[model samples]
Target: AQSVTQLDSHVSVSEGTPVLLRCNYSSSYSPSLFWYVQHPNKGLQLLLKYTSAATLVKGINGFEAEFKKSETSFHLTKPSAHMSDAAEYFCVVSLLTGTASKLTFGTGTRLQVTL
Candidate 1:
């Protein structure tokens, strides 16, 4: 069985500071891991993905995650948080399940940016 776990439901940051969000996952095979950001009432945009390749993966909008096989964790990070980064971030796991490709998402983490 494949599964994913997101550690935080919400995060708050001041503008121009760094951002950090945590995630963990479990899978039978070397699964694909992704971090996606969604604007309000908008579709999910892929931020990054790990497909049994590099351990440290970079994504758009200055976001990056390190795939830790030993720890089974993929935590997203950025050097600075912009006001535009104030959105809901979702940790997603994509895997195959019996004739269907599916995505199991975390509850979601809302990032609040303050001045």
Candidate 2:
């Protein structure tokens, strides 16, 4: 089984400053890591994903995350924050079981931006 742990439930950032959202995962095999964003009353959107292709993966909205096998961590970071970026973020772990992959979502982190 694969699982994800989001360290923080809420993260507040000032507009234009860097942002960080920590996450960790547990999996018996190499799992695919993904970051998803959900705006108010909106559907979830894939921000970025790491599928054993690269250690450092870049995503939309200047967001990026580095997959560290040794640490079992995939923390999302952005160079700067925007008010529009405020939303709920989910760290997901996907594992191939049989023919289809199953996704496990973390607790979710809500990002709040203040001007």
Candidate 3:
């Protein structure tokens, strides 16, 4: 079985400050991890993905995450927070069955950017 957990349900950051969103994951087989962001009434957008290629993965909008096998973590981070970044983020784990992949999503972390 595969599972993912968002360490924080809500993360509040000040504009122009650093942003960090913690996540942990577990899988029986080699897992593919992804971070997705969703703005208000907007469809989920693919931020970044780690598929055993690189430990550090960079995504759109200045977001990035590092895959740490030792700690079983894939935490997302950004150099500075932007008001437009306020949205819900999901940490996802994917397992390839045969031809398709099954995805498991965390409860989600809501990012709030304040001035």
Worst 10 residues of 1 by lDDT: 99-108
What shift in Å separates residue 34 of candidate 2 from its native position after superposition? 0.3
C-alpha RMSD for every candidate: 1.3, 0.6, 0.6
State the TM-score for model 2. Answer: 0.98
Tell me how far candidate 1 lies from the true structure as C-alpha RMSD in angstroms: 1.3
How much is the lDDT of residue 42 in candidate 2? 97
Q: What are the TM-scores, per candidate, against the unseen true structure?
A: 0.93, 0.98, 0.98
Q: lDDT winner among the candidates?
A: 2
Worst 10 residues of 3 by lDDT: 95-104
Judged by whole-model lDDT over C-alpha atoms, candidate 3 comes out at 0.96
Off by over 4 Å in 2: none
C-alpha local distance difference test of each model: 0.90, 0.97, 0.96
Q: Candidate 2 lDDT, tens digit per residue, 3-111?
A: 9999999999999999999999999998899999999999999999999999999999899999999999999999999999999999999988799888899999999
Deviation in Å, model 1, residue 27 alpha carbon? 1.4
Clashing pairs in 3: none
In model 3, state the lDDT of residue 6. 97
- Model 1, 9-88: lDDT tens digits are 88999999999999999888887889999999999999998888889999999999999989999999999999999889
